[model samples]
Target: MLTKMGKKGSSCIIFSIMLISSFFSISISSEQMIDDYRGFSDSNNSFANFTSAGSSTVAISGEPAHVGDEMIASILVSNVGSNNGVANLIIENLEDGISHSGSPVEISPGSSREVKAPITSQEQGSVSYRWWISSNGSHVNASLSGEFSVEVLPRQTISTYLESYDWSPSEGLVLDASLFLSSGASRPLLLDIFISKDDGPLNHLQEYTIEMDPGRRNLQIFLGNPSADSVFVELSPIEWSPNPTSLNYSTLTVNSPSADPSLLDIECTVSSLEPTSGESVRMKVNLTNNDNFQSPSGKLRIVLSSDQSILAESVIPPINPGVSVSYEMVIQSWPDSEIVQLEIIWSSEESSSSVFLSVQSSVRDDGFALPFDISSALLGALSGIVIVLTGRLVWRATSSRTPSTSESGIRKTRIEREEHSANVQTREIDCPFCEQRLSIPAEHDGNARCPSCSMQFNVAKMGETTSSIDEKPEAIENEIPMSFSTDDILECPGCDQTLRVPIEKRPVQSRCPVCKLEFLAEKG
Candidate 1:
């Protein structure tokens, strides 16, 4: 009976151990399954918030595409809620069969990008369209849909015809032409105009590519010279709409140049002083013909340009001889320029020439401080007289305090003191151009010349003072003296390198040897 009890106890212990292990395994598996389910549930809830952040718009570029012509139907998307999602676009509801010429595009959150869908018209007619743009990510999914329409118009017809053609030795070859277009919108048209002399084989003279809008366009083209007695001109179209014509041709006789040798004599003049930089100013110019006899017709080409590039140009009508014509042109200067110039180019069939005019900065004009103003000059003179009187009084007081010397000695002493006082009264001034220091006579007039840079400037209008060169004069009303010094120096504003330049070179344009930058310098 004891042996049987031992066997039963061992069997019960083994069964109890297995039951405990099965309980632990079931608890761990249940916990892991619950965690996975919660994760999937969280992902589904996050996707519910995913959506487009802004309005979507669809449009067609290069519209009115002709039959069999390919164009783009583009969709603009913006502001997604997630980062890096793939967008699949579906375009439907079109009779011409618009295809999705693009694949699903991957985009970033809160950014805009264009998705192009190329489309072509199978036949000419109006068609409606629908677009469904959808995107999906690992954690979210969303979509947007819209519709639009496109119009397919038929191709337009164009025809070429010559209105009039003529040639002259002086005026070149002139052709008056027109093009006819039937229906449709405006487009670019290329024309090849051919010219022949005395009914020989046609030779290409010029090719004009112009935008041919609906209606009759009258064109005037001029070629410099056609060395022919009898000339024939023909108009042919190239790579253009519709078809070209074969019967657009004209004939004309050649004319000779004017016999008067002086008929082309011309003169041009500007009407205003140099303008301020960045100042939009009107420059009026007068062109006069000096020819006394023949009234010749001529073409005028006027151009207003800068040192860098041409700013503006225009073609003016013919000017008759012995008549003066006035033309007003508007131009602007560089905003940062202290000084700018306009290079005006005038050309005609007779001759061509160019001229330049300088424009100064307004800052330069506003900073000028004139030492020779009438009031300032009067003040300086008054100060000099008072100093002379004061010096005499002081001398008298000193002489009375001490024992009196001989009469000749006293007279000599007084004269020496007066001379010393006058010398002390002289003021030092800076050149206006190179900022070179100079010493002027005590009784200086309004005009002075720089010894370092020979820049002659009127003290009445060109005097300027800066903090770096302010001088204190004992008896002079002006802080700056009115003279120039031969030993003055100039400092390059660009590189700060001091240069010893000649006095006569003052108020000149200088190129710094170190930096190679040009600057305007003045004698101080």
Candidate 2:
């Protein structure tokens, strides 16, 4: 009975201890739960007054950007609530190898701020991208997004070279070239062609604006004569758009042959060495080419050396090797008796040669001399006729004279002689051959001789009535009248001498007495 009572007491004490421990644990758990609730309530109360009012914006700023160039993007954030804001800009979905980013920016209340970022692309094409703006502030937490594109232009390339070149005396210099271009945009490009001689300064030869489609094109340029032995040609670009990656300049060197003197032979001869005044002098100029293979052409100039005046100018045709050509030139002789100096000049593209010659002129005379025998015979004949006529007149006078006893008888004999001389009336007639006037007795009609030309012709009796000295004469008795039609008179063409012909013959072949030229005479 005592052992059972002890065990029961121990059991009762253990129960009491367990109940006390349980009560303390319950109190500690309650305190921990209260602390957690208080912390949750405090966090909820802190954010209870936050409000989102304004918004954020994003955009792409730079468009139509070229390849390898930087593009700009912008982000704008506005804060209209009762708190400040912070904005961040980021570019997304850009082309490969292209990127852009910006740092966060802070904005005050009731204000806005912008953020910008630069993006670079390596290739040419349309670059599509997305822009994002993240705004964080005491009253707002929002994100803005948009899509945009940037057009990237392609780079340009240009190259040029000379294909051929030529030079000539007539055409100067000619150049042929090829131009190549590769571009993705249309723009004006300046092309400059330059030339240099013997390492001299570059001279601008030609300038052209390239505005055609991208391809290969041919160009023909005429640079004229530079007058240089060695020339250098260069082609380069002056102005261009979308700056080219490869703009190669081309150059060429040209060499020319050495200059040579003229190789020509000339010979000249004149028609008369001593020409008279009012005479035409003919000169024959013969040119011979001495060159073995060269064919040359130029001008021939004739100048009077005394006054340095040009007489005649003619073009010299192209003469082949070992060829010859002749030219004839006529000039009037000077009026004075002087020496005429002439200069013949032969000029070519490279050289010139001249020859000097002279001519003499003199005055002309009008008188001519006959042979000695003919002059002597004429003088002797004239003297014999004069002596015979004088002797006859003296004999007749002596035989017919009566012995005069007084001075009155002598006077009567002289008056009878004068009356006998007055009965022989004379008339004037023209010689047909020499047109010289001759006096003959009015009653005489027979063959007569012209004293001037020694030409003999027949004279017919004139039917005219004699008038006494007291009566007034209707016509002069000393002059002979000759009336003929124009058809009866003809002029010799060779010597231009006048001849009287019969009217009965319409056309007659006759010989001129002066020049002895036989020709047909006709009436007009």
Point out where model 1 deviates above 4 Å.
Answer: 1-26, 37-53, 61-65, 68-72, 86-93, 96-98, 102-106, 134-143, 195-204, 227-524
Candidate 2 lDDT tens digits, 67-98:
65566777556665544556667786555634
Best by lDDT: 2
Each candidate's clash count: 21, 0
Return the lDDT, model 2, position 271: 78
Distance from true location, Cα of 135 in model 2, Å: 12
Query: TM-score for every candidate vs. truth?
Result: 0.37, 0.29
| Segments in model 2 whose C-alpha atoms lie over 4 Å from true places | 1-156, 165-174, 220-247, 252-524
